[model samples]
Target: MDDPAAPRWPARATAGLCVVLLAWNTLVVPALPGRPASAVAANVAATGVLLAGARWSGLTWAELGLARRRLPAGARWGGACAALVLAAYGVALAVPALRPLLADARAGGLDGPAVAVRALVRVPLGTVLWEEVAFRGVLLAAACRLLPLRAAVALSCAVFGLWHVRPALGGLAANDLAGGPVATGAAVLLTVLWTAVAGLLFAWLRLRSGSLLAPVLLHLATNSLGVLAAAAATRGG
Candidate 1:
């Protein structure tokens, strides 16, 4: 017989919260009053809300892949991944044909000090941290409560891909690289697909190392180091 006193998983609440958060991240935050600062603030606020909701939904830190005891293992795994990303970026920059891939218009105008601040400070805090916390930590953990781990990862990663859709749409409009409606649509689809694949890898890292730190470090390296690499590549041209 089933235990009559056991707490239920609250599937409805989890689904509702995920929906709200998904909209907040993809829609509301983008239209916030101030850019960069407002966006960062909104995301931080969202992270707190996610944690609080997770707690309300009876999720433990361990369930969220953030157990204190797993810190060392997570760090080791994360650090290794980060180092590999740096090395790959270095190689990309070193190779003439691969160098163009790193040459981005985004970092082309950045001065040394600005690049330093953007890469070391802003990207780490504003982008990587919030994203990993939101996707792999809260969302994946919440999904696991109702579905199997594989299904949970799939759902969370799908949301992560959709999370990028707004940004991708805005970005394509701002840049001439993907001109025309069909081209823009294609670019957005590719962006979603690529980000979804990246999200799957991040979820794997989080689960494999038993800590959110693993994905955080890798994400930090990919975004922050990629910025530096882009600056260098742009300067090289």
Candidate 2:
């Protein structure tokens, strides 16, 4: 008989906590008097609560891939992969058919320098870390525990795509130009596909490296290159 007392994977608990926190943020926090401050506080509090839960569930920072000590070899490999992805993206942008799409993404008020700063600070350190923790470390890991590898990967990718649906719908709703809805929808569709592809890649990296650190590095590098490319394009324009 299977040992019923076997400890549940820490990832499962963390994913559940993330869902609850997301709900709380969406529902209760927004109703507070100081909405902005409440939102920030709620997020911070959620992080703290999740971290504590992780510890209690026998999860270390390493499990969540937050333990960054050695930085030479890993950084080198991650950088190379990022460069390759950027080159591919550059080729896509150079194609006349795709140029307009690239231009539209760039046309939003955020310029290259601003993008660079956001990638370096907000994206890599904040968004990437938090997102990886929630998606790869928590959700993917939990899925793997409960399902077969392929199923886990597919489910995780679906979840990741669904998470972005709201923003995509909002973009479609706000589209004003003649081809705005088409463009926005296309962009959103492409983004969803790209994120799914990325999820698979990141999953493979995590499994191969036996650490979340590798995937996190890969994600950071990808975001950094994207920011740099946007900046370069804006400057050229």
Candidate 3:
């Protein structure tokens, strides 16, 4: 529970800023002409903003899961997350029905150069670093200060789901209801649901490990798998 004497406005302001930044990152950035690059830049900027906001809000590194000593543990959890995702991919390959979600039409043939860029720049700097900082670090930490622990987790998870709205919209556009509108809707819902669940898992890891490194690694692994899956599908793997 929040301290009885702590002023509430700063926390509320921090949370509001996070939601706005997420929407801008997901929705606005993608539409910009510079895109990908601009998006990455924006993410980098967001990280700085979150760190500054945390300080302004008087939040500690420990509260945001940034304790240096716990980084190794976070890395281990990240490895576990990667393994789980990879195992899921293995299962998807064996089950045709699961292929649609993993190997969607959007998985278009991999462009080696683009993949390299994403692996090096986009995934690391933008998706993994920026998001984990914003969601798991900043947002969750602020929420925790304002609400009960469980409620805070849920709120952060829900925000995480909304943050993926653009991607889900892209997925819908790519499929064009080839799977039927109902199926498409169901798939989108499932995707968002999964994102929220992952957010919850990441938040738990951050809370337990006391370091954002764990969620960052897990998040990186998760995104990396998408890149790998695209490459494999393109190559007939």
Give the range of the ten consecutive residues with the poorest summed lDDT in model 2.
1-10
Q: What is the C-alpha local distance difference test score of candidate 3?
A: 0.76
Question: Is 1 or 3 the stronger prediction by lDDT?
Answer: 1
Instruction: Please provide the root mean square deviation of candidate 2 (C-alpha atoms, Å).
Output: 5.3
Q: How far is candidate 1 from the true structure (C-alpha RMSD, Å)?
A: 3.1
Best-performing candidate as measured by lDDT: 1
TM-score of each: 0.92, 0.66, 0.84
Where model 1 places Cα greater than 4 Å from the true spot, the runs are 1-8
lDDT of 3 by residue, 118-166 (tens): 7777899978888888888878777777777898889889888878777
Best first by TM-score, ranked: 1, 3, 2
Over all chains combined, what TM-score does candidate 2 have? 0.66
**Candidate 2 colliding pairs:** 112-231
Instruction: For model 2, state the Cα shift of residue 167 in Å.
Output: 3.3
Candidate 3 lDDT at 143 equals 75
The sequence of per-residue lDDT tens digits that candidate 1 reaches over residues 4-110 is 23344668866776688678877788788977777777777777787887777677888777789999999999999999999999899989999988887678778
**Which residues of candidate 2, in runs, are more than 4 Å off?**
1-6, 9-18, 21-48, 60-77, 89-101, 104-108, 111-113, 170-193
Give the lDDT of residue 160 in candidate 1: 88
